[model samples]
Target: MQPIFRVQSNLLYQRLEDALQQGLELRLVTQGDRFCGVPIALDEEFIEILYLHVSEDEDSPEEDPYARTVWVIRIAEILAVAYQQSWSRDKLAQLLPTDAATSEVEES
Candidate 1:
């Protein structure tokens, strides 16, 4: 039997992503407004959000490199994501973009 992580090839795939992208089965998340759900394709690898992608209107004056988009967040940073399903009105809500956090220590 195929692992549950795998996304089935069917109508769900097309509806999930507008451009037709697929990955391991992961939960979709929405921002403060829970009405709309965003299907997030997660990989074990650490993905980076290039500043170029974000719109100028969204950028804050603080200019944080990581604060612009949704990604794996530490408890101190925001609130719930990936695992934290409990609803918080202000906490930035999003699906777990990655399976694991970025490695701080690199062994050569």
Candidate 2:
């Protein structure tokens, strides 16, 4: 039988593959932080992503439309990976005006 870590890695690979195929945004949790991005490439050791949002500190000062940076995270460093969920229109309609301001809190 394969080792437990190997089995878990295989599962993680499969999930990343599915996410890539579906063009789903993913939230990857690592030891220290989390990242959200669309999978651009995947391999045994790394998953590369086009970041959905780059922080100001990390953002490039030059506004070049053709320039893009791919963020690569080690598969081993990822503790968990999950697709970002979209709010349904019906659910969005139920949200109060103040809900938008509080949305960030919900994630925490």
lDDT of each: 0.30, 0.77
lDDT by residue for model 1 (61-99), tens: 436433323443111222222322343532322333332
Per-residue C-alpha lDDT of model 2 across residues 1-108, encoded as one tens digit per residue: 433355344888889888989888889999998888899998777889887443464355646434455789988799999896577755654664667636744766
Model 2 stretches astray by more than 4 angstroms:
1-9, 54-69, 85-108
Residue 81 lDDT, candidate 1, scale 0-100: 27
Q: How accurate locally is residue 28 in candidate 2, as Cα lDDT from 0 to 100?
A: 94
Query: Looking at model 2, which ten-residue stretch has the lowest summed lDDT?
Result: 1-10
Per-prediction TM-score to the true structure, in the order listed: 0.22, 0.56
